[model samples]
Target: MARVAYTTPEGRARRDQLVRAAMQAFAQRGYHGVTMDTIAAEVGVTRQGLLHHFPSKVDLLVAVLERRDEDDSELLSTLRAREDTPLAEILRAVLRHNAQRPGLAALFTILSAESVDPEHPAHDWFADRYRRGRILVAEWIAAEQARGRITSAATPQRLATSVLALLDGLQLQQQLEDEPLDIDGVLAELLALLR
Candidate 1:
């Protein structure tokens, strides 16, 4: 039977620690490169110990993604609450925030590519996330157009798709290349084009 330590506060903390370690390992090494042993060694635990919290590598990855979603949701809510900030500026702030989180950025880059295979563990999750993201961005763009902040020459859906593509490409490039990204400047130029 699996150990029940994860039910207690200490156990939950330990589990969270394992998730953090796994995220770092997975970020540094692609999914195929890291194993249960690598993750357990990160936290000074045996493979069996890690298994007590996450029975399989897939489970660990899912847990890490879920934690990331929770964090991102909270951050997005806080950012959205800045009523004085325009959506464009809010998006630029998000990009700046992403640049500061290299580990998470790398994780997203690696996982997104891996999940393109329909058989991959996170394929559906990534697909759903992208679909929802595109929808939300499209809605935002349409609203901006209605307010006359954005030009109506292009469809909102197309603009949203382009914006998301730029964001993803920028994130990947920022990680793959050691060069610093001028996200704010790039975003400003894009927003200008939209206007």
Candidate 2:
């Protein structure tokens, strides 16, 4: 008999379900702390069933990361496509969106910190992610500079690196503290410095 493909809506939903459950588990436990069995149980699926979608725990982590990135990319492309949208405003919007998804923020923070070990499955992936993220943000900053919306005093490369660092730091703080973060005010201050 021919093998059944898990490409239908049902299959995709199941896969998303597994990814969401895995994100929650990974956020709470970190990559090394969670197991394939735990993720499967969270999703109410057998280990074999979960494996059918994600062959390994590493694959699941990658999926969660990729899903988060895709969502951000889509949101940026869709909502902030206007040339009039300042990069600072875009950054603020992204911060707001992230605040609404604290679980994802936690997952990113925990995995990124733990993935520093060369032997970790997500080490290379996280490295590439940071590299690409910096480049993309630098390009955006350069564009804004060209448009004369941002100050030209700083190089785009430096500005982009700082922006990424600030974002990561903010996420870490939000995750570590129970008090609500003044994301908008903090982002406004950063934007002011950039301007």
Candidate 3:
């Protein structure tokens, strides 16, 4: 297997630049809107050069999603600021985080529809995302339950599934309609239910 050139500082920076350009393409044209030719041109690189980095569109999309995770990792710091309401803080942070990355969300917005099919590259991407998301939510729910802040009857896994479902449903609404979706309000409602 050919080694990906992500180890060097310059290589990493270049990779990030390509991912950002890919994100712009994702926002403007969605998943299908972007092509290898387009992304290569977007980065002012030759198609061959682009392929040298990302051999396929799936690779690039995976990188974009990974970039989202990396960017969202910054939300981790915000979680530390509030010790008492970690779950609430996480929900709020997720809201605030996506609010900043509408393009990233838009990327997701476009891809998620087609992601349902097993053939789609985005399918596994989203599945993995849901798994990780559920684990995080479950962890916080478990903590809250242990502290008697939440109901003991509600299993953390079940609550996590519900929370993630709400987030997905809300995002779907936001994408389908032209009106501005009340992300914070939706999160607040879900948070209240958790309590």
Candidate 4:
């Protein structure tokens, strides 16, 4: 249970603290393992204080996932801005970013399992998210094709779907506990196959 902080700058900072704490709890402990009290304690706040911002665990989970998505989107755009050439570099940047977000891996793992059932609240989010990601990646692939850097054989849509599948599957593997996952090596191999 993370404390509910207000939406002011200071409050947002506080809320961010709570979100991070809750993310850790949810990730390391899983969704059912976390309690509001545990989250509040992690953030050094009373349950009531936490409830002020997020009234339920479900709400907190949604917020954590949403913020994580927003942050990742910004980071990806930043990476794109830093280097638009060398498609491999762009893919590597995104892979490295995902490795850095341990909590997002856990959230994604749970979401993936739940999303298959159509009844899950996160189903629509994941569905729409993948669609958007595929579109963006396809556009990027088309651009690279236009630039003649990439071989203009496969259609951009097919390449984009493959790339997105790799990302999701890689993250899924990484979320496993006590499993040896070589995400970097896998990304390198995939980068070689990107063309």
lDDT per prediction? 0.83, 0.83, 0.79, 0.77
The ten-residue window of minimal lDDT in model 3 covers 1-10
Tell me how candidate 2 scores on lDDT.
0.83
**lDDT (Cα, tens digit) per residue for candidate 2, span 57-112:** 77887788788779878876865567677888878777878888888888888888
Worst 10 residues of 1 by lDDT: 1-10
The candidate, 1 or 4, that scores higher on lDDT is: 1
Q: Which stretches of candidate 2 lie over 4 Å from their true place?
A: 1-4, 7-9
Ranking by TM-score: 1, 2, 3, 4
Q: List the residue pairs that clash in candidate 4.
A: 1-35, 1-36, 1-39, 1-40, 3-50, 4-50
TM-score per candidate, chains pooled: 0.92, 0.86, 0.80, 0.78
- Worst 10-residue lDDT window, candidate 4: 1-10
Worst window of 10 by summed lDDT in candidate 2: 1-10
lDDT of 3 by residue, 69-185 (tens): 777676766675676775766776776677677777777777777688888877887888789989988988999888877778898999899888877778777767888877777
**lDDT by residue (tens digit), candidate 1, 42-104:** 899998988888889888888878987997898779876874555588688778777788789
Off by over 4 Å in 3: 1-13, 77-82, 175-180
The true-versus-predicted C-alpha distance at residue 60 of model 1, in Å, is: 0.1
